[model samples]
Target: MKRRAQGALEYLFMIAAALIIIFLAVRYLTRTSSTATDLGNSTLENITQELENAGF
Candidate 1:
């Protein structure tokens, strides 16, 4: 009975650890993607402004 309880507890801990890792990874990816998007938008706006100034 004690062994069974130990096994269950270990499984729970493993699952919790996996979930934490997954959450962290997703958070990191979202932040990275948002930063990239902002960078791209700013670059595009700069290009458009430059083109308009050049009489495009």
Candidate 2:
């Protein structure tokens, strides 16, 4: 019974660690995507301003 309990505890710890890693990965991806979106938006705005200046 003691051995079984130990094994269960080990599995629980492993699962917790995996969840933390997955969460971090997802957070990083989300931040990167947001940054890319912001950069694209800024670029578009710059282009529009330039076009207006050229009377387009």
Candidate 3:
């Protein structure tokens, strides 16, 4: 009985740790993607302005 309890606890701990890692990874990915999108938008705006100024 004691062994079974210990095994269950270990499994629970591993699962919790895995969940935390997954959450952090997802958060990081979302932040990175948003930053990339913002950068792309700014770059596009700059290009448009430059082109308009050059009468293109």
Candidate 4:
């Protein structure tokens, strides 16, 4: 009976660890994507302005 309880606890711990990892990964990805989007927008704006200045 104690062995069964130990096994269950181990499985629960692993599940909790996996969930934490997944949540952190998702959070990191979202932040990175948002930052990348902002960077892309600024780069596009800069290029547009430069092109206009060049009379293109």
Whole-model lDDT values for every prediction: 1.00, 1.00, 1.00, 1.00
How many residue pairs clash per model? 0, 0, 0, 0
Error of 1 at 38 (Å): 0.3
Off by over 4 Å in 2: none
lDDT (0-100) at residue 40 of candidate 1? 100
Model 2 residue 43 lDDT score: 100
Give the per-residue Cα lDDT of candidate 3 at 43. Answer: 100
TM-score of 4: 0.88
- Per-residue lDDT tens digits for candidate 3, residues 1-56, read 99999999999999999999999999999999999999999999999999999999
How would you encode candidate 4's per-residue C-alpha lDDT over 1-56 as one tens digit per residue? Answer: 99999999999999999999999999999999999999999999999999999999
Report the C-alpha lDDT of model 2 over 1-56, residue by residue, as the tens digit. Answer: 99999999999999999999999999999999999999999999999999999999
Give each model a TM-score. Answer: 0.98, 0.95, 0.96, 0.88
Q: Where does candidate 3 have its weakest 10-residue lDDT segment? A: 1-10
Give the poorly placed runs of model 1, Cα more than 4 Å off.
none
Model 3 residue 33 lDDT score:
100
